[model samples]
Target: MADYVIKTNQLSKIYSKNKVVNSVNMHVERGKIYGLLGKNGAGKTTTMCMLLNLTYPSSGEIFLFGKNPKKHSDEIYSKIGSIIETPGFYENLTAYENLKIISKIRGDFDPYTINSVLKMVNLDQHGSKQFKDFSLGMKQRLGIAAAIMHSPELLILDEPINGLDPFGIKEIRDLLKRLSREFGITILISSHILSEIENIADVIGFMDDGVLIEEISKEDLHDRLNKFVEFEVSDIDLALNIFKVLELKENEDFTVSGSTIYLYTHLSLRDKFNALFVNAGIDVGKVNLCEENLEEFFTRFVSNN
Candidate 1:
């Protein structure tokens, strides 16, 4: 329990007989980024709300830093900062000003931290920009800056990057990674985007239909991915037919996408397959051994169950 910053035991949340979160035992290691991943309405936000005490669990216990939150709400919550969806800031307030107000409200106003957090979120350059004028990505960064201004040991954010552009997503991703690595701030962030979480989280907890189906480390998930050999050739049909003649099945043994055909069977036969393609007068452009992506894994995982 001491090792985990946030630990849950059978945490369940039911609303009008529907279990939004059911018997989820989540473990968030100290100083690690834990990504709670699920599709919309998979009870991800509900689980986070339970952890923040925004809502109560139906029949489970929550432990933060090995202490019961119910017993030490003030002592526990003071060390945590969170953004549930979008956090509010004064529309006319500058990035620095909004955090100044937050710092004062939290009664830990340190002038140095105001600038430091802004710089960390890349908002220092836009220090004078009003919250209303900031771009969506900048707004998100400001929200993060406000969350961390007090230097909370743990930060919980729910779907923080749900509506950002590619550049915005990368901005927030790098910021979170920096917070975890440089500042040692433990983060519990939730998102429906598997690819984003796969990029940022140290550990991932997969949920569906209100149940936590799997919890695995990022490295372990990669190791468990299904391996396939992808080939790019001058002729797609000829290459595919070669496998077809050998009685290999589409999807089952291989799948063709665009100009490439992937082989799931005979994983070690890449060289042989390449030789066969070359002998068949097919120009082999390139070949790669790719693993099943997080999305592919999630789809297959849910389909199997």
Candidate 2:
């Protein structure tokens, strides 16, 4: 198996006067959840469409399982499944019957596969319920069941948690983790829900205005934003002088935001800085070590880009 289950090199797509996807490069490692995040109309969906061969790229190359997706779409896609936009189903058909039709199309009539996937997605009890009667969450789960029914090596979901309740979202989140960790399936999921993706994604790729800006592991984000003590002081000059005396300013490890300063060091210097402030007749009321969240980290890339 290839180290990267999906790879796109300098992919480009143009529409009339606008460039929908501009030379975006993506790498999805095997058996990992790689989240594609961006603002609305950031070309996230277009990029996925190109990868799945739903739309052809105007330029560049794409490979799935080390085979060209354009030339060998049917052969390569046999091992891949995707649910983009919305899950399509016959509203009148029951969940079981709907999945049964999909199974027939895949040429796999194994009733056990259908039942197993249904149970895995928590839709087993809704077997006789018509698709129209299923809730939004149940419908989403049923869509996932259809996607993985054939046991594809790769699963692509676009906004899997869209319009889902908190409980529903948590359920799907756990399911995706189970798919990656237990079944060893690589998932390429796109969503504007940064926090939810943060919980499940092993790797994250940020896309903006039709281009990929950065791709980093979840640990990399924590390591980058970690070890910074942010504080709000009444006197900015006094704080600067104290940091300078401590040789922290010499290393450019200090950042000022209005009346706040992020001491890019360790929390061990909490008492040291506090004492310096008191001796200097400066009052320090609130000092907090900022805990990094996915949204905060994601903002850095989006704004900078």
User: Which has the greatest TM-score?
Assistant: 1
TM-score of each: 0.92, 0.86
Model 2 quality (TM-score): 0.86
TM-score of 1: 0.92
lDDT of 2 by residue, 193-238 (tens): 9999888899889888998998989888778764667777889887
- Give every collision pair in model 2: none
Deviation in angstroms for 221 in model 2? Answer: 1.8
* Residue 41 displacement (Å), model 1: 0.7
Question: What ranges in model 1 sit over 4 Å off?
Answer: 232-251, 256-260
Off by over 4 Å in 2: 230-268, 276-287
Task: Summarize candidate 1's per-residue lDDT along 199-297 as a digit string, tens digits.
Answer: 999999989999989889999998889998889999998988899887889989988889988888898888998999999999999899888899999
- What's the true lDDT of residue 247 in model 1? 86
